[model samples]
Target: MALRQISDAICDHLAQPEPARPLVLSLHGPPGVGKSMFHLLAAHALYNRQPDRPGLRCPGLDCAGYKVLYGMDYTADERAAQHSALRAALLDHVRHAPESLLVVEEYDKLDCPMRGFFRQLLENGPVANATLNKAIVVLESNLGYTELHDLLLRAGDRSKIAPEEAQRVLKDMVFSRWLAEGCEERSDTMKMVGMVSFFLPFFPLERRHIRQLFEMRLAERGAELQNGQLGALQWDEAVIDFLTEKVDFEGDFPIEGAKEVATLMTRYASRPLRLWAAAQQQQLAAQQQAAKKGGGSDGGSSSGGVAAAGRLRVADGGMELTVEPAKALS
Candidate 1:
């Protein structure tokens, strides 16, 4: 549902004959439920035709047309300076790349003044003669996570939660939060809230999602191996299952979602493969040195001719990664 809404919003914004205002979206959810990942993948999709391969290599803040701002980075002591800097940067960004993406993470952490800044920006009003009409603004916040989680618990399936209910609940929660957090000017805040095109709720990730994340991380690890000319890392469903079980779950959902996936993959999957690759490279180098000094193979094939593939599996009640040398051609 979130994906569909975001895609439609993007397409509609791009198709606009004369875009009156920027497409502003408010993403509400718990931590680690793929809110950040979703925006990154969305940004990648907009800029390039590359498949959404899981890894941290997405063209996010580095992209010319994409900008990300963290609310926490704006310290209270330097609030005025930080706010001006942010305002200037955003103005410049929109002027340079009209059709762009701007993601504000930790939106809930921004103080009343900063909230006012965003409120002004989202109004589509003139800002030094520059407007955000052609930009897509995403405000990521954890404001309505409790409501979202409760809805998920009741619904069982995330898709079971009605979009209308989700939007109503999340928007009400966000508005109430802003009020409680001192959104000084009530009328302006209300107008800012009304300008948002969509309030997408990301629910807790189920076991299936976590399993898919594990597979993606493993695939990314394999890509790393292949890119390094270390053949590939092989794993079956058993390996995936083993890694999936490593995540801690509460009820039907993972406690931490996919947050710890990278750490777990590095420790259990990527580390052993990396060690093997390093050892294999060292051995191949030694063999090449020996061959150069009259230590040639009897079969006339170079000792370094074979590349090894690392295979991971469940073995002896634990995990095992074994490197196998490729067969030489006849």
Candidate 2:
């Protein structure tokens, strides 16, 4: 649902002229539920320049047009000063990167005044005469996390939860929290909150999602080793399962989601992979040296160098690196 809404918003925004206001979205969920990752993925998809593609020069968070501000970076003690700097920076960013992405993480942490700045920016449609209607603005918060988490826990299956019911629960929680924190009286807060075009909720990731994340991280790690001229380190599905199982879970969902997956990977998987790659490289080098010496001493040559192939797996309650002949990959 979140993906569909975001895709539709992007497609519509790109297909038409500048909108009257920026594409404002509010993402609410618990920590480690991919709220922050959403902005990163969106930037990569929109800005990663490919052959015959129309995009920014860089990809993902590397793009100059992608701006992220953390709430913790600003304090109430310096709200006045920070507000000046923020306003100037935002105005400058919009003026330069008309078609841009701006993500504010932990947005609810910002003081009422700071949020009011965004309220004006999103409401008035212009900043210092520069229009922001070409940008995609995302505000990320964990405001309704408890409510959503409870709902997910009750439903057991995420698909069983009604979309409208989830939205209503999240929206109401977020609005109520914001109203209490931001406004003294019930005045005009809804006007600012209503500026958000979509309220996207990131549900807790399931085990399958956790497994997929492990695969992606492992694949990237493999590429890193290959690029460094190390021997290939291959793994079977069992290794992925092993790593995925190492993650702690709460009920049907991962406790930390992708947050702890990296640490767990490094602790459990990285050392084994590194050792395997290094050992394989050393063994291959020794074999090649022996082959070269044999060819020179005897007036005979051998076929191609021995191909070193190994598979990493979980066997006998421990990590097993098995060297074997390369077979056709399924």
Candidate 3:
């Protein structure tokens, strides 16, 4: 669902004059699915908040938060530090805030029943230091239902999982772990004494969507920007078509040709850079040999050099930033 739609539902629940379920909106999805951007936009649209401030907190755990001291390997001590850091961050956010909409980017970083306790907190916001606070917790985890379950099997990270059966295996593993840890059972029996739990669906990637995403990015990036609606970038139509043709739309692999084009453009940013790098590379060794024989380097040439050069060089005076009157006739 769109962020607004979901937020509206949460708002409806809040407008209950009394809320049965406090606003815990879980913006979950695998990376590259635009979840983070959505999280930012949602926070802005709903809470009038920026991530840098305290009014809204949607923290993502980095290696530091994981307490892996700079270049040190992951150890129990480091994990302990990370755990402590995470708990403190969560508690701090919940303790004092006008609107508590916590988006925990990687909730799965927590160990064992830590997830269970956190989930319980989500389903039942508890009292801290004798004060009552109505807070919402969104646990962002890629483990999904099955992977989390699969993790509990042998008490190790390595789960005997098949590629195809990954989802089911994960679900069962997490479910089993929750059951074993007595969290699911306890939460169910006690009617969730802390916070509410909600799962955001993992989005499927599509090439068309990726292309559109690039266009939007291009629009946002100054390659093209007109109005609120993103228009096609100023790239050559032929080049755009050529790119779309090479990009695999049906191969199931997540390939983004437009992004490749953007990178190519970025690398070929300067005239000398493009000439020495790309345009010159296309001239071929045979051409170089021919050029050497002819005394300089323009060797066994391919007329395609123009096209390669064109990739970097725009028309000489065709596209200028500041326009001058037709120079009043030479």
Candidate 4:
């Protein structure tokens, strides 16, 4: 529901031309709810022809031509440089430039005061000389459900602002952003929404979607998926159920936990070194025992069970058998 809700909002918002066909959508959600994926889908919906029909118009930005700079920690120089670069890139991407939409995921890093810089560009209308071309901007937020209330309050939002201590911090920030030295006013509602901030409501991510994310990632890696191939790698119904139980069906996931598991797998047992390592380590102890006796090689152990019972060898005069304890060694 979280992604679908976002998709629906973007599609519906731009369905009609709201002046210059400007459709600026801002989405706020917790991590792992597929916000990026939803944005890609929304882009496709903008100018896409149904697969059932050919010679279709797929309305969306060419991602290769687009530059998506994640606004995270940046020095002032880094921020300014990237900001200018992004604007320049956008102008170049949209040739004869039909309005290209810029989806700024995690936009809070671009302080609210400087937000008006964007406001001015959109509201005043980009000049032919300006770096930005005719483009709609979609500014997404990192505000998770828990963080939304605080952020809205920080943005001078009063009606739904909570009364918590965290809420107080947001309220103070809002005051700073709104009343601060750098903040500017915008008379244009559409431009304000695009350049500044807006709210995106939350929805539940059903259990099916959670599993789908993993499958989707694997598929992108060229893993051929059978009906149960997704289940084969590190998860099954039991695991999914156990995971779903911890999630807030509204798509807010145990993101930390997921990262932890992926980290553990990568660090300990990821591909090119899984059971083979464990088996090799296990064989080491057996090899030492055989070395003490010193008849069979480090790997060849006929004392153990079937594993040590290596393959059979046939000679001209008689039949002799040799067994390899470790299949990896064999």
User: What is candidate 3's lDDT per residue for 228-293, written digit by digit as tens?
Assistant: 122212334343343344445535324432335455334332333323333234454445566566
Model 2, 161-270: lDDT tens per residue? 87677778877876787887845355667787677788887887778898888888877876776665654557778777777777898865787767878887777776
Q: Candidate 3 — which residues are off by over 4 angstroms?
A: 2-5, 16-21, 26-28, 49-74, 130-133, 144-197, 221-233, 241-250, 253-330
Best by TM-score: 2
lDDT of 4 by residue, 91-194 (tens): 56544445565666666566543465666665566544543333556666555545553354454533344334333343334334444434444333333543
TM-score, each model?
0.79, 0.82, 0.52, 0.50
Comparing candidate 2 with candidate 3, which one achieves the higher TM-score? 2
Ranking by TM-score: 2, 1, 3, 4
Root-mean-square deviation per candidate:
4.9, 4.6, 14.5, 14.1
Q: Against the unseen true structure, what C-alpha lDDT does each candidate score?
A: 0.77, 0.74, 0.42, 0.45
Which regions of candidate 2 deviate over 4 angstroms? 50-62, 182-187, 219-242, 294-304, 314-330
Worst 10 residues of 2 by lDDT: 321-330
lDDT tens digits, residue span 1-330, model 1: 788888888998989977989899999887888788888777877777355455534454445787888754565688888888878888898888777788989887888777777777778466887778888999998777668879988887787888888999888887787777666767766786798899998887888998889888878877877787677777778877887888898876788877878878776776577776897677768767777677576558675444467676665557554434433211
Among these predictions, the greatest lDDT belongs to 1
Q: How many residue pairs clash in each candidate?
A: 0, 0, 21, 9
Query: 246, model 3: CA deviation in Å?
Result: 7.4
* Model 4 error, position 250 (Å): 14
lDDT of 4 at 192: 56
